[model samples]
Target: MSEKSVSTVVIDAPLAEVQAALFEIGSYPEWLSSIKKADVIERDGENRVLKAKLAIDAGMMKDRVTLDYDWSAAPAALSFTMDEADLLTQMDGTYLLKAIDADTTQVTYELTVAVSLPVPSMMITKAQKQTIDAALKELAERVA
Candidate 1:
């Protein structure tokens, strides 16, 4: 696994609204350009996504991946781990949300990804940062 990359952004939305946006995994493709498709495979009792399958196409990386979500820390944090993928060996990520004010929220994204092929550590780190930053930017736009 590569070192985790973290990025933060402030969104012009309430905490609940930001949380709702992140919880709606099926809508990811609409806002996340790298995510070509997102399908919820399973949902918990609370109607939160427990598992999902996502088709991603991000330049050099393209793969269909299934991920298992951990919503135990929800309302503030959402985390996921890769379950199956063609190219990814490990994909663990978390989104942490904090209410900065009634109409503003701070979001922090942390990601660690590893591919099946041999890649340089520096390249992996760079890719991770790029992915995290892009995701955060997209999320902010999505909730705006």
Candidate 2:
């Protein structure tokens, strides 16, 4: 495990709406600035993504990554772990949603990732914050 970056944001949408947007894995590139492409490799019986390949360009770091995804219906959460990647040694993250009102939801994102290159912890944390902040803002806009 590497040092983790955790952050939260409030989305101007209901919990269900926010979760729906998050589950639309194939549309990630449209809203997530870092994601260049997202392709589903496999799906479960419920047609939910089981595996996906993503190409990401995050300024200082870039990689084509494959990840295994798990969705927890009870908690309205989505989590993923890296199955393989060109530059990333480990990638694990989760998105947890909590409703603040009928039309507002709080989203918490936590990520821990390690790249193959030697980079300082401060740099990694800085990148993580930028990624998280951009992702949450886009997510909010997508569901708005």
Candidate 3:
């Protein structure tokens, strides 16, 4: 485990719209550059398990993660905790949504990614944070 990175952005869209865009796993690649493919292996209400293969400029990395997503609950927060990965270990993340106004929403993304690659730990953490920030921005634009 290493230092966790958190990135937050405010989107000028309703929570429903934002949630809808986020839940559409198949459209991830359209917004997130790193996500080469995302497959929803299982789903039950607010819980989902997905297998993701991400490709950066260097190469491809794969991970299977289980996420507990809920919008029906108060405060409107979505969170996830991943199982151990073959390449990466102890990867955990959370995304929170809060109503800033009637038409604006606050989005926060938090992740703790343990990199076991040949690269430096700082490099991995920086890349992960950049990816998360970019993804959230793209999602916000879509909802807007």
Candidate 4:
């Protein structure tokens, strides 16, 4: 599988705050454009199960998929793996928050999303990058 990746925006909030804000996936539609609905399905230990539906490309494409998440609070890392994703053969994303200074942080978002959907548009990477960008922006705005 080929690797796809992106880096997130650095939020002004502390790592714990940022992590906590991200856990509120249900509020994504308040700030995120592509997210239509995000519902937490279950929680097991430090992992979470989610069912997410996203609208993409002006409602031309939509996907509802299950995801499993693993959070490492000590290192401030949130990792997601696809359970069954449409328009994706395999998908994985991670958010890494590292303390840069007292009131600043370094946030990195990375994803590897594979598309076997009909025609493999050369723009898949661009689209995924835009998604991550919007996510980072929302995170910054919410947690900042």
1 against 3, candidate with superior TM-score = 1
Compared with the true structure, model 4 gives a TM-score of: 0.79
C-alpha lDDT (0 to 100) for residue 82 of candidate 4 = 81
Candidate 1 lDDT over 31-118, as tens digits, reads 9988999999999888999999999886656789999999889888999999999999988999999999999999999998889898
Which residue runs of candidate 2 sit more than 4 Å off their true CA positions? 73-75
lDDT of 2 by residue, 4-103 (tens): 9889999889999998889889889988889999999999888889899999898776999999998765347899999999988988989989999999
TM-score of each: 0.96, 0.95, 0.77, 0.79
Candidate 4 weakest lDDT stretch, 10 residues: 52-61
Q: What overall lDDT goes with each candidate model?
A: 0.91, 0.88, 0.66, 0.68
lDDT of 4 by residue, 1-144 (tens): 535758657778777777667766666677677777677777656455344434333132356656777654535777878887666676688888887777777788887776666634446666677777877887888776
Model 1 earns a TM-score of 0.96
lDDT of 3 by residue, 14-77 (tens): 8878877776666777776666655665565545434333332313335544344443443466
Candidate 4 global CA lDDT score: 0.68
Clashing pairs in 1: none
Q: Which stretches of candidate 3 lie above 4 Å from their native place?
A: 45-75
Worst 10 residues of 1 by lDDT: 56-65
Residue pairs of candidate 3 with colliding backbone atoms = none
TM-score-sorted candidate list, best first: 1, 2, 4, 3
